[model samples]
Target chain A: MSEYTPFEMIAYTGSRVLKDERIVFVGTGLPIIAAMHAQLTHAPNLYMIYEAGSLAPILEMGMPLSVGDTRAARKACYLKGLCGAFELTQRGCADYAFIGGAQVDMYGNICSTIEGHNYDKPGIRFPGSGGAGAMAANCEKTIAIMALEKRRFVKKLDFVTSIGFGDGAPDYREKAGVLGSGPYRVITNQALFGFDEATKRMMLLEVKPGRTPAEIQELVDFELIIPPDVKEMAEPTDEDLRLLRDVIDAEGYFLKRVIKK
Target chain B: MINTVSSNIKNISTLEYKEKKFEYWGPTPDESRKLMVNKSHALKDKRMSLKEAVGKHIRDGINLGIGGFVNTRVPVAIIHEIIRHGARDLTLSFQSNSICPELLAGAMILDPDRVSIKRVELAWWGYEIIGIAPMVRYLATNGIIEMDDYTNYGMSVRFKAASMGIPFIPVRDHGGSDMELVNRGKMIECPFTGKNVYLLPACHPDVGIVHTTAADMYGNARIFGAYCTCPEIAMAANATIMTTEKVIPTESIRSYPNLTEIPFPVVDTVTEVQYGAHPGASYGYYWFDMDHIKMFRSICEDFRKTGNKDALKKYYDEYIFGCENHDDFLEKIGYKTLKKLKDMDGGQPIILT
Candidate 1:
């Protein structure tokens, strides 16, 4: 058994879904790592668009400090403004969008705003949404990465800031003029999931090394579909770990906090 | 209370009889008028020093509104003082799409509760999280602090409405999409666009803390490059705290007054903190400190995973707070980290700023 660092795990999870000819709208962090891993391995031509408007620029390794990290400008073939990024997304130019959801329901509606317990007073607030609204609505396909937990994966979202897969993917599409295919997959540390193509509800596709089907199911507030063909996700390889470490080079990021005697 | 009121009436009566034979029932109407007048802007139009004016109201839980988009136009000096004083629970509200590395560093080393309402994290290209985005997500997942997420246009529209002082602004865009959050009633929504359109309310914050390259003593602030939504946010806030690099006489504003977007009347207090956006050193003032950016990212990432501020504070004390100035912050984080970061293969670090 090979050891998997957090970075390697991130790259492996991302590589599973990203294939060639996929133009992925990427945010910073895990999505970028995953996209990069895909670029390194199977999907050499994976088109990665940063929110600040770089398309398929050569990204430096390790985690980016931010989406606008100078690396983006240094590595890109082209650069566009915030508004320009949306223009591309709205026109169905992007193939896949990797986004994060604060709260998600069984329907694939995301609540990135307040937790929805109190509309007037939120427990916490984020920087206002940027192109997420357009990307969530217009992109051809979407993938949401929410770290695992019942709080994150809920029965019903407090609100849907972004729509991935809804109650009836077809029904929501008719109601909303949404052009995208909805959330294609939901990636978390615990497992990998996708919506049932027919029902558009979450169906568990793969699980992490230490997770069991029942354990994964129990953590979700809503019912998750466990397909009969569910398999264990491939653990991170040593080479993958080395690349991730070299590229992301987050030395002493949490070393002091790691409780060394 | 009745005896005091009666005594006050008698004293007024005696004084009036001795001087001009005036009658008083409830003290003098002029005295009451004076009291009422003193309550509103009666400081006699005097200009005070930055230390004197800024000392009183700077405290924790205070929301600071920064100008500019990311690191381009932030108030560096005030941020420096904020770190110097160890301000806590300082929720920042900005118009630009996301957080900057400097601000992220502050949140990482200063405060981990990077309170904001941006819809997404790291929306800009090349901006690195320095570990803040993942940290923010980690903290949000762990319930360390609240995370208010909105879509990009959603936050912008909300800021626009806030600037206009409109109670709510209805957006026709983003309707009938999965990303239409405001319409779902998860946030404030208008009844008309049940589909994809949303109603964003005015975001009148507690304080509008901004920094500009130059300003007049009368408090007219002008920023060079990418104004973002700073002026509008300042106008919408309850109080506006401004920091400027250069301070000119009020008469200086008369030359190119129209350029002064923030008038003296709009600014509550102005601190002359030069070269303020440290680590993200203000454009044209100093080169961007890549080392500082890496430190900020690393700290943010550490805070995100552990949700431990004590540890963060220790790091800050060792590196950030221990430093005398921005240069020290750069030194403690070390050029090695930045050089190592430079060696990474993929994209450059994309900071939210």
Candidate 2:
């Protein structure tokens, strides 16, 4: 019906990944918007656990400034301490954890640590891993949401801030004593990627509309594992965009004005 | 070739190296027990001025824990006092900080040559180096303060271990990341399961400061919403300082014993400072003063651009040093604005049915 923003598309895609009645471990930014969208839309029974310990919050009004925002705890089912919230993940309670990172490698290992190899002397230091590492290690599955850029999609992360499929081998996480299976899908601006079962390397699953495989290849620094049955990513429908704009992000705090023509 | 053995070999070697290099920094289990036993004698009316609390307890080179997650319920008033009193060589330990750590690092409070105080050391997990507060990046980039990083969960569990008076706690997370490499903890076999687990050592700060909605004159504190790590921090720290919106009578606190997060025995000082968590939200009391926070950010940005402390000095002078105390600071915020903020929310705590 109307032109939509890329953030709307990304949020819509992220919402689509969630199933009904799943327990999602969500953080502040875009993940909150996506999870809220899912709750309002298809997955009404989805339970949300904010990293700051607000569990199943009834997000009534304005978007919460942070996971620990008082609004998040306002009608929450259970408000735990930081230890208790993460302990749930450790106990294998969360069904999905939505996270974003600075860089993600072919193996889906995300790096939010120092850009330079040296920890002492970093060329550029992003914020060190918060709860993303723990969630990735403990959740049943992790969904990495980030803008698609060549710099972000790398051959090797500067540092493994969160383990996905370590070294792209089977039983790698098991051997590493990681309880979770790492990222199941990486939702990006241009496309969606899923890990190959045999290799555990990220493979191109779908390209977004109006984008070609050649263009997607050009955007990535590393070689993409292209599957033969790769299909075009479904664009946000009229209803999806309507719900996203009207109900989910009514204030357009996250999805509004972010998209550039 | 699966190449599983090589990876396994690499991991085992790393694990062995980590174990060999592991060193505990804080008090031992026995020492912690002794300290708790010594300190857990009696509960007194620890009510004192914010100045007295900061000056008497927060000394140079003491490991400090400032409690809060992001902007909610942070000890801003206490932090301002710390800066004003010129506490030096303070080693700050926190998990998932927002404005508190950024202000501490950016305020040039740690500049030894300039301020003539010992440089501050910061050990944090998940700093607000993102869009919210990027001054930490500037501070770290210039080597203004020594920095150590940990995962949020790791830091929380460390506080839990300290509270429990245990030497270290076993965790299944943070095994494969760079956090494992840099973490002071060692990878050990869980004797029960014979599986590898990270043993995060106890973190007992010399002083822990927390701001809450209400507390009694005897230091029994209660937080209305989102009690992140304040309770754990209070239990873990050697001494706890509480700043509250109001100091209620002991009877009121006793009426709701279940809501008491920090008991009087654990708290060493109780300072009554209304709107104490200014520029930050104090749950049901008031929302975050975004304009003030923006002003803080602008000052930081000016410092970043000019590489001069003039802007920071001006900010400190006007907001912190200029004010005599929390009351003076509240005066600067203006009563009308405060009333408006308080009234906007009906001046009531959200009671969830």
Candidate 3:
């Protein structure tokens, strides 16, 4: 297998995690690329719901730079507005929410709102939760893509923009009035994670080849529930890379970008 | 008042935000209804110049409901006119937007006495793919403006509820998130199912500005793209100032009644301005001008990073204050850029008749 970039690996991993014939509520960038790749390869029946009100768009106009891009609305089966799209999620039509965030905790609560504890004044202000919060609250399962770093994988989030398994309580989601099962998977280039069914804490399911679970644990601020049988993540074949590069993100709008240091 | 049922969100995040009192950011349902009842319901020709339309409704301290989700079909033309008209201490309400609010924020930064945003109630603000909105980061981080955050659905349904003449609507989101505490929404037990549900207060903007694909002189507007909460926003506002890419004949509007997103009665003024959402995409007409958005965003970012208002002021001066209306603004954008953007649209289909 040819070496792939971290974004490609993340996209390929995202595509791998998705099941066929399901709907994914996608944000811009990698999530869209992942859904496109999944459709082109294994999960042709897997459709997408864009927050700007498109469902099952053919994406023939190439990769949409934004979810609100007209290309995202092209040849959509149903196109309404934010209300129509998210109402569908709330009504249980969407199966998976593919999202990204600035910070995440062990329980999978994602933060994309702020880097500082202060709400009014912040050290750095990331974009507020546009649709991820609603998607996380209502979509049956939440799948997050994050850059693996100690600062990002923190013990505490500055803000919980998307709800995961809050406080690891069994009735946390139920009492919070959210419908999602919560925090199904956390995908990074180096590792893939899932929540423990019993504990609702993040569990290391797989790691990249030549990497150790302990090394993955080094990057995270919180302790991950690493099981003994951590398998190596599947590397994207050259064909998968071509599908991602040539077919999905032909303009290198997302796939070819360099990760910020 | 509904008693809180149950929640663990207080223990989840490390955010230490002050508890916001529950209050309507704009008109209450009763006030909105009464305002609608008092207005003339005639199907008169509401066609007016952008200047006149903005002058009539762009008042200080009015809640301005912005239409469009992120970069698509944003009300940039109206925002320019609003900047020129100069509204102070404004309250902006939107689902998600890119250029509209940024333009306003830039104007506020250039001259606060002329234009100011006191607070914003929104889901998100930033130029998608372009970058984080610099003006929002600047204003918010400096504590210059207040913000009430909600999900895209939370804000959209707030307008939807106002349009439906309801006081509040229940949703399943924001209960476990910090939005439940910071935003003016309430969490209550379901009257029927004994389950907890979050209720968002209706958002009835005092003046809603929207740019549409087509509209007649009577202000019956049609949106070809993703509706982007335009229909609800138009109906939710006390007065709606509409700008359209084309002024289709009323005969054409009548030929397809279902195509109308904002009906005649809901809209107060209509201005025919092609490329109305310039820089932002208008699905059937043209695509978003990514370069222009990038250039503007960079300028704003420069101002944010350096606290230098020269470039930002020049941009507003050259584009917004320099122009008489949207036509003048589009003229400055030139035929080539607009043509390229239109070609990029790939002729998405929409019906005029």
Against the unseen true structure, what C-alpha lDDT does each candidate score? 0.54, 0.75, 0.91
Question: lDDT tens string, model 3, B1-353?
Answer: 45666575657878888887778888889999999999999989999898899888888899999998888888889899898899999999998998999999999888999999999999898976778999999888888899898999999999999999999999999998888878888889888888899998999999998989999999998888799999999999999999999999999999889888899989999999889898999999999999999999999999988999999889998999899888889999999999999999999998877
Of the candidates numbered 1 and 3, which has the greater DockQ value? Answer: 3
lDDT of 1 by residue, B1-353 (tens): 11100001111000011121212211122443343345344222324544444455466565555555554455554555455555556555553422342444435444444322222222221133432244444444345443333455444445445556565555433444323322221222224443433344445555566766677655677754334456765665556667675676666667777667665655677666554554443323443455555655666566665666665567556754586655565565466644453243232222211
Better of 2 and 3 by TM-score: 3
Tens digits of per-residue lDDT, candidate 1, A111-155, equal 654453443343443433455655777778778887678888887
Candidate 2 chain B: 10-residue stretch with minimal lDDT: B9-18
Q: Write the per-residue lDDT of candidate 2 for residues A95-177, one digit (tens) a residue.
A: 99888888888888888866766555566666677778888889899999977888888876777778788776676677566
- Which docking category, incorrect, acceptable, medium or high, applies to candidate 1? incorrect
- Residue pairs clashing, model 2: none
Which runs in model 2 stand beyond 4 Å of their true positions?
A: A257-261, B1-29, B109-132, B343-353
Instruction: Please tell me which predicted candidate would have the highest DockQ against the true structure.
Output: 3
- What is every candidate's C-alpha DockQ against the true complex, given to 2 decimals? 0.13, 0.49, 0.84
Write down the worst ten-residue block by lDDT for model 2 chain A.
Answer: A252-261
Scored by lDDT, the top model is 3
As for lDDT, the candidate ahead, 2 or 3, is 3
Docking class of 3: high
Comparing 1 and 2 by TM-score, which wins? Answer: 2
